[model samples]
Every structure is written in structure tokens, then in C-alpha cells.
Target: MSVFMVERDLKGISMDDLAGAQKAAIKTAAQMSDKGDKISYIRSTFAPEDGRCMCLFDGESAEQVQRLNDEAGLPYNRVVTALDLTP
Candidate 1:
């Protein structure tokens, strides 16, 4: 399968929410992304100033990615979009 990335905008999450030992949301997301037989990449970034989280999953299609996010208890409100700089 090909790779795909899902961009997320997380609002209302405080810096404290992103800090310390409670990283279950991120851990769950990684596990969910690895559920579809194989593993490629599962990543997330936070814009603390803006309270936004941009998550990227590289595997399968939009539907598969959405499913994984849903299973991970994440926000699945996404539009079909992508970018590639490979040659």
C-alpha cells in the first residue's frame, strides 16, 4: 500500500496536557497505525501556542487512516489531502 498523511488541528489542549508522563493519546495512535498488518510511520506534532496537533500517518488510503484514527480515540474530522516530494 501507498503512504498517506492526515493533518489534524487540536484545539483546547493545554501545554500541561502535552507534558509529563501521560502520553497515552500518542501511544494509542502509534499502536492503531501499526494494527493494519504492517508498519511504516506514525507521527504527531503540537503547536502549543495555537493548541493544535498535526498528525501524519504514512500507510494505506484515506479510509484506512481515518479508521485508525477513530480507533485511537482521536479527532477524525479530516479532508482528503496530501503532499509528496519524492522523485
Candidate 2:
């Protein structure tokens, strides 16, 4: 599986909405897994000061990550393959 970074621009998003989005992501990812589509939500980072959010997912491909977000009805700007650099 490839890791992906999903970006979203949601200005003035409330905490409640963010919580809901996380919930949706988890549910959708689990459903996808049940259907034999390997997708896992790693975590999320939010820069509320800039109204930007980034979600990390490990999946088959970037397209799968995009589909996962779409199925969750989460508004996102883009999904790109992510490479981890650990020292």
C-alpha cells in the first residue's frame, strides 16, 4: 500500500465539523476494508489558524485515497502520494 497525503481547505471549520469528518473517514475506511479495498486512515493534522487540514492514509493508491475521502463526503483539495523520511 502507498501512503497518501490529502489536503483540504476549509475556512472557518468548526470543531464539531472536524470531529464529524474524522468519524466519517474512519467509517468509510472500515467499509472499504470490509469490501476488500485496503485503505487505512493514519491520522490528521489541522492548522486552524490557516484553515488548512491534512489527512494521511495508507492505501493501494492515491486514487483509492481520493475515493475514500469522496465516499466519506469530505471536502478535499487533492490527494498525493506521500513519502516518509525518517532519520
Candidate 3:
């Protein structure tokens, strides 16, 4: 699976809501995977100062990642193919 980054603008969002969004992403990814879709929520980075959030996921394609976010009701500016160079 390739990694994809979902960029979101969440200005003025509360911490609780941010956490909730994360949970929703995870839950939705799991549900999709259970249904035979090869997708998983990897992690997220949120810059509270700018309300910019980037979520990472492992999936078969960018379209799959987009669908996951859409089903989770998560708002994203864009979804793009990304390289996860975590050593």
C-alpha cells in the first residue's frame, strides 16, 4: 500500500473536536478494511496555531484514501500521494 496525505484546514476548531475527528478517521478506516478494502489510518499532524492538519494513511490508491476521509465525514482540502520516510 502507498501512503497518502490528507490536508485539512480546521481553523478555530477545538481540541476535543480534533480528537474526535481522529477517532472517526480510525473507525472509518477499520470499517472499510473489514469490508475488504486495503486501507488503514497511519497518523496525523495538527498545527493548532494554524489549524492545519495533515493525516496519513496507507491505501491502495489516493482515491481510496479520499473515500475513507469522505465516509468519515472528515474535511480535507486535498489528498495526495506521499512518501512516508520514517526511519
Candidate 4:
């Protein structure tokens, strides 16, 4: 397992859509959390009209988590960093 700090740039996402996306995120988190792995959401900022949103996350490997997200049809926008935190 590893811990990473992910940062994203925004584009456009309505408040309603943001809520829906977050709902999806939480559901995805539940699955991720089940495997002794999880995501701790740091923050999210969005601009509704043009469709821009940025979200921060601190948790497992970005690569591994991306796979998990892809499995659930919710891949990450980008991988900020990935580091091993196993002891």
C-alpha cells in the first residue's frame, strides 16, 4: 500500500452533477475500502457553467486505485503521484 497526494485541475461541473459524481465516488470508495484499501477525499472545487472540477485525494497507489476506478467505470483524471508506504 502507498499514500499519495493527488491534485487535479478543473473545467466544468454543475452543483447537481457534482453531487451525483460524489455519490458515485462514495460508492466507489466503499468498494475500495472493502479491500483494506480506501480513499480519503481531501477537497473538491467546481465551476458549473463550463464543466470544470478538481478533486484531491490521499490514499492508496494512484495506479492501483486507477485500476480499481476503471473497473467501476470511474477512472481518475490523472495520477498526481504514487509512492510505497508499506512497512
Give the candidate number with the greatest lDDT.
3
Candidate 3 is scored at a TM of 0.97
lDDT of 1 at 37: 42
- Candidate 3 lDDT over 58-79, as tens digits, reads 9999999989988999999999
lDDT for residue 3 in candidate 3, whole number 0-100 = 96
What are the per-residue Cα lDDT tens digits for candidate 4 across 1-87?
Answer: 444443333345446756776676667767777877767555455665655565555666677656544655543467566444436
Alpha-carbon local distance difference test for all models: 0.56, 0.91, 0.95, 0.57
Error of 1 at 71 (Å): 0.5
lDDT of 1 by residue, 1-87 (tens): 555665656567666754421254456546765664442444556776765665565656777667666655666457354564456
- Of candidate 1, the 10-residue stretch with the lowest lDDT total is 17-26
Candidate 1, position 70, lDDT: 67
Once fitted onto the true fold, the runs of candidate 4 whose alpha carbons sit more than 4 angstroms away are 1-14, 82-87
TM, every model: 0.60, 0.94, 0.97, 0.60
For candidate 2, lDDT tens digit of each residue in 32-60? 99999989998899999998998999899
Cα displacement (angstroms), candidate 1, residue 51, comes to 2.0
Clashing pairs in 4: 11-51, 11-52, 11-53, 12-51, 12-52, 13-51, 13-52
Worst 10 residues of 4 by lDDT: 1-10
**Number of the predicted model whose TM-score against the real structure is largest:** 3
| Residue 68 in model 1: lDDT | 61
RMSD of 3: 0.5
